[model samples]
Target: MYEQISHSLLNEILDELQPNAYERRRDLQHFYTRLGANFYAIHNLFERLYGQRDDFELQMQRLVETLVRKYMHRPRELKDLDIAREKDHNWFLSQKWVGMALYSAGFAGNLRNMAAKTPYFQELGINLVHIMPILKCPVGKSDGGYAVSNFREIDERIGTLEDLQTIADEFGKRDILLVLDVVVNHTSDEHEWAQKAIAGDKKYQDYYYIFDNREIPDMYEQSMPEIFPESSPGNFTWNETMQKWVMTVFHNYQWDLNYSNPAVFIEMIDVILFWINQGADIIRLDAVAFLWKKIGTTCQNEREAHLLLQLMKDCCQVVAPGALFIAEAIVAPVEIIKYFGEDAIIAKECEIAYNATFMALLWDAIATQNCKLLTQGLKSLPGKLERATWLNYVRCHDDIGLGYDDNDIRAAGYDPFAHRQFLIDFYTGSYPGSFASGVPFMRNDKTGDARISGSLASLAGLEKAAQSGNEQEIRIAIDKILLLHNLIMAFGGIPLLYYGDEIGTFNDYSYRDDHDKLGDSRWIHRPTIDWQRVELRKRQGTIEYTLFAALKKMIAIRKETTAFADFNNRHLIDTNNEHLFAFMRFDHNRSSKSVLVVSNFSAEPQTLDLQTLAHEGFGTSGQLIDLYSGQQPVIEEGRLPIQPFHFYWLSEY
Candidate 1:
């Protein structure tokens, strides 16, 4: 790490530091040590990114100053927490942590009320809370708070920054982790920088991709696929005030930041550290794949983007080493793995990533009533870095895109295009005998592409069954709900539950009335929680009570299972039964502590041959216990019968 070039440059930069900064460094011994330890790698990455610029040294000096300022502003309690996390680096990779993602306003009224609902999370056994975006943005063009008009200020519609601090304080006392979002990809056109650009500030104009005419935009549009093809249609939106075109990959109001400029990179880094100082344990970088763009390429998953992420990570390490990052890149499996960094042993970029492929595959099994594609797709999922893990979930505040690979679809004995279309139709209730009540989102007319949007309960037939008043159908619907929860709970990662899924909350049709939300069908699943309906969770025989009790039991069991800790210890078993999906999770240190998870996706009873898992320590003579049920599985004649839409967490007793 102490290469001559990097060390010499570091020494030069240290000598050139201002008098106040030099004195501050002397007082902050730990900061000085961390900066020294990380400076070589930081310099190397920064040099790789901006080495050719004339103001390279100036930018390097600015980056270090930003780190020092943020470190100084970090609270004393957080500093102690950081040191503790540093001592226990792999603390997050534990079975004890369960996460729930919710909007502050939807879950409770605001940040203050959300803080008071700590008991609600505790009652459900959740210790990690991902409060979706609460930043200031334009009223109608917020894109669900993804478009930020002010990076440092909290939205007035929500509570103030002080209210957020209160939640952090209260959650810290209850030993809960707070995950916040940093929309790193773009900002609202109403942002200060964008306004300056509109005001003819040439320097600010350089911050975004502003064009004089359609020539450059036309060239870029050839390779850049439309994100919102139906609504936004194209990648470039013409600005009347500036008489120029700006690149708007998501929506016209969200202007993509030009990462080709080092200043822009430095500014975003400062913004990330700003949130870390605001008591965010983990920062989810939104739309990370589109960070760096090129004219001729797809402008996604570019090499420069990865380098920029690496640089941001190195800087974060220097200031807040304990704080973690979650990459929100929902791309292909191969490309998504790189967000964990290409390191062999350690995750240098992001410590966590959304297991989107697993999510999509789970839905595939639900629609097809088989695990063929789910098995094949997972087999194709690349192994993650040893230190990195996944954030497994059944649903979130977004639409589900069936981004399965064509080869995996073909291997599962289905046509790629036709299979995707079937999923769209089946979930939208357009296919025959389909019980799902999902709506279509972002349907591209030119390409015939679309995504599905609905709550887990609605998509699993609970809504339709309840409406039909069929007892048998309702029971099967609840079974399907628990079956999906069982898989994510035992899967090798921190299982994330959506806000109202625990009580089987249905899709809200009210979004159709709000003009801003009418166009986005994903809002159907982002329903406001009805406390009155939530009270039904305590009333016996109600659907809410049944779901809440089952999910709570599963979460408790998941925490107690030591093998559920994520260390890349899951093995996908070939059940050879199309209607059945099976996998084994084992503790890397103690292989004897293993659990075999088996689920039946069909409506008919299916038998699993015990001999198939004989090598997994389930022999004919031993007793096999289902951890969730706390009873011995009924295995007769070397076969275990699983009831329809049921699952078991079996272990040798």
Candidate 2:
């Protein structure tokens, strides 16, 4: 990795480092080792980005100094963790790891309060917790705390930095992983840098994509798609204060950082390392797909963006190698795979990514009462690289967009356009006989595109079944909910359970009353955690108890089954039956001990011919037991019978 120019620059920077007599020399040595290891790639990326600048070496020196200072500021315990993780690099890929994503207030009252709720997570068998964005932001203009005014400080409404540290320390004691969000894509207008830019500070103005007029902005807009057409409308906003146009792809308050500037990249890297030093086990890089902008393109998933991530990761490896990065890019399946980097074997960029296409395909199966599309879509998805895993979840704090490709739709025996319209109609309750009660979000009149927003319980028909007091329908609804959970649990990845999904919490219409959250329907699913409803989880045979107990049992079983670990040991079994989807999970250590998972998407009983899966270890006359329910599946002749909306985890006994 040593190059002449880059190596000479590193030596010069090290010599300029005036190490005091008090442990400063040790700090310098640590920085020197890390810089020497990563400088080759860093220098190449930096030079590629800003080689034309007159002061490239000065900027390179600034970048090195930033890393050294952050490394010095990192606490001893986190540094120790970095070393421990380097020894055991694959710790996160274990099947034993289960994650839960929750808001600070929704899970507990604040950061400090979350410490006392550790037992609550334990009860649900969750060890990885993603505490959604809690950084300080301007009131009401926070964009769910993503529009950060300060990166180092926690919001007063949540808790202080000390509280966050305490919570992280407590989690470590119990062997839990704490994930936090770093809004790397943008900053709030109220942020000091943004404010300085608005105040006509020429140096700070370069931090963002600020232009004197629409001449340049309009050119970029031609290829950029509007993210929030209903509310934000366009990709650029005119700042009256500076009399200039600013790139605001998300919201007017959230200004996109100009990553084309090396200084901006350096500043963001410092912020990322700051959070890792704060004890974040995993840093979720928000909105990474739109980092690098260019003319004549969609300004997404650009090649330079990947290089920036690779450089950031390389620098982080020097300081906090234990802390992993999760790419928060929800783009097409092809683009999503690139976030893991194009490396043939190892992932050079993010270690984890969201499996958004699988999520949308599951919903498609539900709406159509057929697994045709799900199977086709999953088969078309490109295989991910080694050393990288997916964050699989049924729901999060955001709406669900139908991102299925048209070719896959046609292959599944459906018109692409009509099927998408059907899914939207079914979820929004506009289609006849649809059980879902979701509301539409960001409906675009130009493209007729929309997303669904509602709680898992509501979308699964629990709310409707309970409201009508239909006992049979309620049982079916509960079964559907459990079926989805079972899939995510047995699936080859970290199963991220959204808060309130365990006890079948319904949607809260109250978000319509809060002016700050009223515009976004995603708040419907992000309801406050009702302890009273959670209490119902203890009452035997109750709806809440049914879901909580079932999910807890499934989680325990998943942890024990090493076959479920993410080592790319999954093989799909085509069941010919359009209503049934099947896959096999092979244990790398004990190859003979594998599990065959099959689920029926139909309301009526469905059957899968056991002989068809013989190649994948399932034979016509073998003794197979359902691990989730601990019962024998009904096998008549050579076909296994699956109950209405039922799923099975079958293991040979």
Candidate 3:
């Protein structure tokens, strides 16, 4: 927009921006300038959303007013950091980030205790810690802390605000980033807004999608898939007090926030900035795919949802510039990439997104013990934006939904539905001769679509090994865990380890005894980290010692290596061994060396023809070095051999 024209609009909003209401200083001026730059996009969106209302301009005026007020309220230190970050725009794309996702209490008991574990993180080369939501929620009914009751308030059971501040400060001193969840799509029904809504407050009731009857909700449910079928079946829940039905996507307690309402968007935006200002470097926007809903649509990855995110990103840039966003949208591979946004190249959307496709591909490799599906899936994955990257992980607090592409499955010569059904059965031990001991989380009766939930160790075959007490099986299980970890570490993105996976923490069936938790199977994997088990990491022979030491080494290696970057430099290699998954990460400049990562998923020994690698430019001259084994390859004519369930991180000959 023309500077004069923007100035005219600014003149119009000057009363609301309240130039005198602020200190009328350089900071306020700079904020006003940013608002002017973003005003066009924000105005267009806000108006398109609420322009029909008589108070559309009033809401835009208020939103801009809120941004300026928040900027002025922002701490000076954070402001300085934001200024510095604006100067170094791509600062977040650095290779130094290594992440771990864990519950606040499960990891250390409280926020203060989590802060105390800063040294532990530093030791493990972790620079980003995604502490699962520590906000207030109903004790047992909470969806593992996701059913947020308040945005700004910390859960009293976790710790005080002071503890969070201390932890953020501690992490800052060491250059570690703190990542927190902002459950933007929903809030606990007991939240103040929900309570007001229950009391028949028309304004607050509009905060959620409330229908007088089930007619509309049932129509929406015709297309919307059930996230937790066995636990929170169906999308609508009856509210006796209001005598209406409300849409609850995940759980009955988690009332989906009405994004169609501009008020709700503004409030959530405030909540987002609230935490970013409070020292959350990266805010994980939880369940973002379900943010926008339309009656006839599946209500996943709606266009307005993307626009809302784009607006959120623009607004945040005007306020908390240093903060980053990780979109927690686990949709189809194609749909998942859009969370980064088409306008992402201009810093107009999320900085990072969960590489759910790659995650699902890795699991496919685990199940099929072949790279065909993984390779096919990788080929189909849309390239991520240059500025945005992926948060790669094998498991999180949520269940594993096989969100693979049907075309890829068909290309691999398997019936897509049957293959997925097979995976569900294999993981849940319903299929004969399956090694995995997982549970079916949300089994949708209508479509037979079920998500598997279990700890990494249990799902990876360690639990069964421990019961057998077979030395060979236990060793293989440990190798499989480390093997997956190695891929994530070297796969050119921020690798996030689910809290207890480092020490092979198996699923705990104890949650079945708790009334609130028994229904949610994902809780089986959210085990409390045992400090004693952690201590045994020093004792070489124990399971904890072996798994922890191996994982710690992988983390150290990843931190030291510069080749692991998330740019589009990866190439899938055909090793001709079904059990071995091989890929290469190349330097973008093409001058630097590339790393050949070969992961053997099977227990039996697997070999790849060194000749096959020669065609891919691995045989430039001398012997290739296996980073994990630390052994120089016996490349006679450049053919390197590998062991069973083993991997080699090879550089150029």
Candidate 4:
């Protein structure tokens, strides 16, 4: 019955569409077929959220029209790519796909220059490059390009859209995947829609959550927590021009969209498709957790927000089935897994999501010199849908938030509050015997909460070691860096490397001198690439050369290891040594092909009893070889000793 209703509505929408679109639809019979298959689910989802509104049918027509237009705009090459991806739907799950996230301008001066430097990424065995947000945004007011003034236009400081197309073209030839950001939650006040809203245009005002007064805003503030307490103090900001209180969850200038309005949903869907047409293989939906707002709720990770994502994903499938979505939801482990969609097998919302739990747990292990909480946290993390995978990384273009579960912390034999405070102090160099040189960010005075910010090298103790000219300390830091990278590479997902971490770049304190960046400590890690420093990778014995060479080798080995593919084949091993984090990975098709990954997180050596893993075919193995170093671990008294900050990928042929 619902299918008939959806088809009837689609027919009406098709008839009302322009003649050009109709002609193009005939050329795209596949598009028509896909629309026919998915429109029912789309319609049901849309109606579920907006059926009570008077403009329900009209909004439905507009939504279908948006999908049709974008489908027509998609180039023939992209359509062909879509068809190819459809045939191999699980292509992204391959072990060969290693990713790196970076800013175009910061990495190579501009889009064109970045394209010219494609060999740099290829050299590091990176085939998935996530260029950070480059859309047009207000100068000085842009939250690092997340506050988009214009969705379609590229930021002038970066190159033009044509340059981005060039990147897509060039990267395509290299078989590289291009990932782009779509800031779906909010837009800059300088945007045309916001401008009209401020000018008292009723239609534009409906695009955002602009309230007449503070009555409803006050109700929302009661439940909603402040995101950036030190910088952006409140959830509501007063706009004097319209005498309205607007929802500014992140910052005052960035107005949150009213998802209750179907028009807003249609507009964002159009923006997403436009970028997909421009050559984004993967679209990272920014701040997906904050899409829906409700009174007496945290306004994050709501059910309606998941429905919105599902709708957006369905629309994209009809237009470009190959394009994958990455949910950038950095909430708790339980909440974050939902972004992968609540399906028994296949993911209905996003194909990929950030493994923030794993990332933060890695940091916790580094700080505490143990895997107690890391192991406990992994146990508590909900298993994702089979079709989805994790985007694992140590750091990105954001501050590190200790959003660990208190239960897991307690299970690890530590007080949650005191443990978190210790991590904060250790990273900021305030704790005794700390080697990290990170800075505190967005410290909430009321809640005694704060996040740490710094480059990976700085946080791993390279900065202090280099500053003090301690060669021994520098080697330890380098080992620590490699140890972190090794886990992510072998950790059942696509390991995302940040731009400068491969070459051991330190935090740039110069961000503090910039007027626009002074308030944000995250910018300290977003440093401009020193090509001169990058050149050091060619020189042996240099820190850059050592780190880059080791990482490149690991990436190559990871690509060759069939067991490294993400098929939910990872099993955590009980080592009984708190300093050792151990897990086993097996090829999903051939369980006999397996690797045992074990790492020592402490400064002191640790031993793993081979007897514990004897039942899993380890102690009686016929010559266990380390795939990483191609060496054999000497087992004495049924125990394997591991050096400080070292790891091994043990396998038996």
Candidate 5:
């Protein structure tokens, strides 16, 4: 991108880059200074792809100009943060983080109201908040903001962009991280680019992968999997106005961008930095696995996808050094780990990723009441790089798909295909003895693979038990929820709670009446917070109070323990009690002195052999205090007995 531009303009960009980005000859060189190297590699690739265009270098110059302009516009406070955190780059992989993902409208009705609900985060000890896409999109057709028409503009229904800035500032002052989604994979058919594309402009059409007929699309369909089986049905959509078929992998409205074009990558990089400079401490890269697609493949987790992520990481480091990235890929465990990048050893990609495999495995344990697969699955998970971590959660806004390996299912003594069907049936209450009330989502007719959708409490039997007036069943459900929460908190990473789960919000069947939402079963679990139930918190003898109090107590205790830190160091204890799941969170510096967390999964008392635990460095030289109960556990003759569905964080003298 060599240019004979005036030195005065170059001086302006150099001046801006110098402030936050360290200027060094060799040592302590920032990634920003190395931009020219990235530019060389990218320019060579793009030139090879679009070499005939005379405007290729012109576009390259404009892209660099945009980066310089955005860097200059970045706030002084954020710039200062970049300079300060330049050395200790992996600050995001910390133990203090606890995230909650929510929709701006569903969680609080709007961004302004959501600002007022910061106390909700405080009560739950959450420091990381991921507000699912508040960007503008088409009505009734937006795939929950995945089909974003504009990234900078807030949807008319969700207040203004100023409200989002205010939320970010307030959260920043409180040391809470504000995470926003950057849906770089696609945009709505109504977006300005899409409109230009609809006008039969070849240049605008190049921004997306558009074909005049189904010849190429049908070739892609040969290897690509349909995301939404019942609703969207396919990966390509026909636009009658343009008389072309566009790639819409998730929904018809979301026209997948063509990242093979360098101009598209540069534009998305600007959009990403736009949010980061707007005060976002973290950015969740949504559907990043499908960012780069090629022919003759499923077009997911491709080599080009990894290259794109690397470019993004490099660009972000130049602008917002303090900001972090969480990869949102939910594919199989093997592919999911690649989101961290093979270059993770050098901290080249995302700092955190979703522990979706653990989420799926936990569901497996719930169904089978055994830990064989869960144990084996945990063993199969490769230890993450030093500077990366996992965002552990039980249930999120999306449906839960069984993403485990088929071999793991078979080794657990269940047929892979039949087990998944059983899970969907059990959760949807189609099974005769099922206590759950979930709905089936994305049921693939060819493979019979389907995901289950419901809130944690609803699917854990609380909804049915609460409606049937069965106190014992309800208690058991609450216990199971807490037990699961215990696993997330103790398993050496940040534990994220879905907003409604804290109050046991049930499945809201109200979506069934809405024509737009009726087609998607995931809407069942997208329940708004029941203010009345939330008000019942701290009240005795109520379901809300019981769940809230237990969770609040656990959160308080988790924050106070340094051993709870995540460093990819947790040892599973085969306590020999099938109903009990035991694990030790050992401090890397002090392995001999560690807290032992034991959870009883059954509905009766279970005993742990203290002598067996002592082999893992647990001892009874003095009184053992239970952190959650705030009481000294009674241990006699080297054994600790736990009540049904109870968990203990045992600390010895």
Candidate 6:
């Protein structure tokens, strides 16, 4: 990428990197070195994005200056961390990093109060905490803080900026990683820029896609699919004040930013660096797939979007190298992998992305009571870049979209559309003999596409079992919950536990009474934290105690087991029993140490032939112990017996 003209321009800019007498250029050399290494790529990306603009050189200079200013603002401790991380780039891909995703308001009422629950996280072996978006927004139609009104200000109702800093300081002391959200895709209409645009500010109006009429929006909508057909039906909404149509890919209140505008990109980069300077170890880039738009296309997972992310990563490298970006793009599995960038040994875009495919496949197994689809789905999922990892979770703050590939569905010997409909019916309790008690979200009447909305426990049948007062069903539900937990923990990634899932929190129907929340069924799963109910984790024999204790034990074991590290060394073994799914995890360092994970999805006992598993080097005569129960599995002759809804993390002593 030796562009003579660009290189000369960059050299000239560096020559002009003069500082005032009062300014100390401490670590300015490190910043300059990084800038030199990354500027070529950054310049190329910027030229491609805004080369036609008249102020292209000015914008490039502004981008470079923004990085230097942010680097100066970064704390000394963070700078030291950056140097340490530079030495060990793969530090985050370790087995010890178990994560928990929680809303700051629900977890402990506020930022300062959340510090009191640090011991709770420590006791559960959670070292990474993803605090859901807490930025300032309109109270009622905030879209759960994704519609960020202000990038720098914390939502006062949740806590002040000082409170967040205090909690981050506390977390740092305990070796815990604090993750926050940066809603990079869009902003609330109440945002200052949006307000200015509403007031006929032509400069701010260019920040978003605003049209005088629906002609262009109509063309864009011809290809852009509806995100929330039940609520916001179109991609563009007409603003009465401005008398113009503004592009809003999610909700009308959230205006999509035009990344084509270099100024907007520069502003977002500053916003991201601002959070990193405020002690955020990881910033989740929310809705990254929809960042770039093009007419006659889906406007998702586009090439330009990736270039934007690469530029952001390069800029962050010049500033806070210790901070990492999580690509919050829940797109197709193939597209999701690209978010990690196509680098051979390093991630240039993002270091982590959500394993949405795995989450959907796990739910498919729950619905079908078989592992055929789950196995097929995983086989098709592309392996991510070596330096990047997945944030694997059973459920999050969002509803579960069945985004499975049709090809995988057909490979599992089922009709793609029919199977999806069956899943919806079963989970919503409309199908006969359905055990799940869940609700449907964003049901598109035209396309017949719907997503399931419910807490993990509710979707696993705990709510239905409790309602029926069935002891056997309750036990089965608890086993199912543990079985899913076992897989995610032993899965080749950082397993993120939703806040209340460990305690078997069920769906809260009370959201229906709130006018602001009733429209979004996702609120059903986001119940307020009940401390009184959380105390049940201490009472033996209670469902809460059982789930909490088992998860705690598994989390501890996962931290200790080197075999569970995310090294992309997992190999699936065909048990020939449709109800049983098995995978082998070998230590990346020690070839002799391995763990064979087998889970039965059916409600009946299943058997696996040791002879068949011998192909995977697991048929040896060594004693097979279940790590969860710490007892030898029942083996008759050569077959291992797995109880109904039971999973065994089998390892040899």
Best by lDDT: 4
Per residue, candidate 4 scores C-alpha lDDT tens digits across 74-140 of: 9988999999989998899899999999998889999989889899989999999999999999999
Ranking by lDDT: 4, 1, 6, 2, 3, 5
Off-target runs (Cα >4 Å) in candidate 4 are 24-27, 619-621
Model 5: per-residue lDDT, tens digit, 235-283?
Answer: 9999999888999999888999999877898889899999998998889
Candidate 2 residue pairs in clash (backbone atoms < 3 Å): none
TM-score of each: 0.98, 0.97, 0.96, 0.98, 0.92, 0.98
Model 2 C-alpha lDDT per residue in residues 13-117, reported as the tens digit of each score = 867866552254354455557667878988887888788899888888888888777888888777778777878888888999999999998878888898899
TM-score preference between candidates 1 and 5, better one:
1
After best superposition, candidate 3 residue 422: deviation in angstroms?
2.3
As for candidate 1, its clashing pairs are none
Candidate ranking (TM-score, best to worst): 4, 1, 6, 2, 3, 5
**For model 5, which pairs clash?**
none
Model 2: weakest 10-residue lDDT segment is 19-28
True-structure lDDT of candidate 5: 0.81
- Give the distance in Å from residue 292's predicted Cα in candidate 3 to where it truly belongs: 1.5
* Candidate 3 backbone collisions, by pair: 610-639, 622-653
Please give, for residues 425-447, the per-residue lDDT of candidate 3 as tens digits.
Answer: 99999888888989998788788
Instruction: Please report the TM-score between candidate 5 and the true structure.
Output: 0.92
Measured with C-alpha atoms, the lDDT of residue 120 in candidate 4 is: 92
Cα-based lDDT at residue 272, candidate 3: 90
**Tens-digit lDDT string for candidate 1 (103-208):** 9999898888998899989999999999999999898899999999999999999989999999999999999999999999899999999999999999888889
